[model samples]
Target: MQQTEEHHSYARATWQVVEPYHGAVYFSPEAHARYEELGADNRAGYFASRGAALGPASAELVIGTFYNFNPDLVHRALPAAWQAASPQRFLAARLAGIDATLHRVLGPEIGSAEMLRAAELAQQAARTALRHPQGRPLFAAHAALPWPDEPHLVLWHAQSLLREFRGDGHVAALLAAGLDGIEALVTHAATGAIAAEALRTSRGWSPEQWTQAVQRLCERGWLEQGPDLALTPYGRERRQAIERTTDELADLPYAVLGQASCAELRRLARPFSLALARELLPWAVDRLAAVAD
Candidate 1:
């Protein structure tokens, strides 16, 4: 296997392997139910639970940190979400939900020795991320939270910190590239990784707004002027550059882990991540399979 110390590839690989395990908290039915009991609907639950780490942050703060969702959508969820549940309550519910979900999805493996080892390595990486909070708001906010005791929960929390660390960097890269939220989604859609309509709907963008963003991309010569949203060659290169920058910014924690430990963490985490993806995020299965290769 290629070592993480070789270059940026290790950082990206680590992210891909662990993402499903960390991200499963969002899609878990147990999490949704907990939020629902607090009087937060799905949208409110999603924004509030994720943003609760920021300590009742405003809609604008969420929009800035989230960096790709519609402002109006964020506005609809905030303050109201806080009113339904305090940040502390939201955070507690989030942890409880994660506990229940992991137990359900991972079963006996949650307490396995391999899990303890993965948690140790992941927490080490997260500590490295903690040292470099500098401009990473979401990551810093999460880093302030107390660490959980269970191996599975520790692994989840550490990966959450690392994911947000990368996410904060990704947002910085997007801003540096001069791509606004809608424009970023437009170009992402043009790459055909996901359907354009799905991206628009998930981000709470209107059809007209989606069309306008497409027009803006076309004006920038980043997209073809046809019915389909296809990237021009230049557009592809620009997109690749943005990803490269994100990877560069995200490499620090893995770099601290060194090649052997990074490889070990990936090896230890892969099966658990794959299990979570199979249970909670079917779309990620093929991508995780490719990484396993």
Candidate 2:
């Protein structure tokens, strides 16, 4: 692998380990309790609390990269929370939610200190890399937000910020290459996770909508014609290019950490990630393996 590929690989490994923990909020009891305290009742309420912290950003902005959620749900959820609180209040609530969820999931022991240390290292790297002006609007906004006091929470928020940073950049890359939200999902379906049917259900896209997106890609010569669509050479190359660009953009932070430090961070984070995966995420091990492949 090339140097950039190596850097991207390690960065992805680090992300995979921490990502499940961040996502645990969706299922965690403590997270729901925090949301209830914040006057939120359902999943939409939780999404609104966190999404509002990204500023008075439009639902279009959130829906673009948050591709899996139904747009109508996001539209409905955002205004209620956004209208009720100032950005500062929303951010505070968001942090509280993260703290509650992580504490419950990770507990007091099980390498919490090591996780904090690794998070600090990763945050430092992300901060150093973010000095440059970039098109990562969501990331830029969150990066400017204040940090939490507790080390574990700090790590969770920092990792959240970095993930948004990378995600925003990836969206930019996708658009530049002429792939829209559904189209991108169509391409992604060609590789991992199953087919367009799975994406349609998971992402709340209707069959007609998915077909339309696939048709668009077909017109562009990126996808082969027919019901069982696959990526043509052009499609494969375009997807690869998008991925490479995203990796390059996201690489700066990991590059700042360098090889040895990056490896060490992964080592420190692995056990926590594994434990969480076993307890919380049934598909996480398979997801990690797919990334490695």
Candidate 3:
């Protein structure tokens, strides 16, 4: 079914509002500690835990699914991370960390009726996503896991599925726009949604590789030369089109769930999202700013 503009807005809104709650594990000290216990360093912890859903996935698999990280960085982390800990162990550690992190950030709210309601609603929408997982390998992998019994954990896991479902579509959109992994990062930085240096370093792209991507974007007339990375008008339009396509692809679950239920989920999830963002997400300012624009 073709998605209406209204449904697209709901899909994007739902994603932005629920993001922090699902994303806290990435920055949670508790989660990091758990991965460390399994002999995985921070990078290994991130790659292993996120990729654990794919079993003992190869670096090529992770690199292809993850879409934007440096392939060398992926190689440095993968099979090695599996050697340090099995995918099952990595999954367990991530859940344990999420449990600890949510308890610390959300406190008494973890057991609230509101939390359960949010969890139930999010899960319903997530189930809708599960039906259409043909090309969404990451989402399909995560969906194959059993649902967590706890309300807060259920909510977190549901959002994880929904986010990855959308993310897979976003990757398709980027590819359709003819952007490679490095070019994707460069164009995103050019939009100023994130500091170029911050994104470049975090993705493990060398300064030289970053410059090359920037030059590629410039040659495509998608970027402008200056002291800093900047997107030309055409670039901005192209990026917007990519985002629109992504939102449309992601609209199915929310559209199936209907607007009112999604609104309630947003309302119930927002406080938790805000609390998690305040405590765990310093980098979210970049994302929040991008949303505002």
Q: For residues 97-138, what per-residue lDDT tens digits would candidate 3 score against the true structure?
A: 999999998899999999999999999999999999999999
The lDDT of model 1 is: 0.90
Task: Output the TM-score of candidate 3.
Answer: 0.96
How high is each candidate's TM-score? Answer: 0.96, 0.86, 0.96
Clashes of 3: 0
- Pairs in steric clash, model 3: none
Listed per candidate, the RMSD to the true structure in angstroms reads 2.1, 3.1, 1.9
The C-alpha stretches of model 1 lying farther than 4 A from their native spots are 1-5
User: What are the per-residue Cα lDDT tens digits for candidate 2 across 1-293?
Assistant: 23567788887776676676566555556556666666666565556655665676677777864655678767876666666655566566666766765666678743467976877786786676568537777677777777767777666676777787788778888888977777888998875556567677766678788888888889999999986779999989998998888887777777777777877766766665656677766667667545432
RMSD of 2: 3.1
lDDT of 3 at 151: 97
Models ranked on lDDT:
3, 1, 2
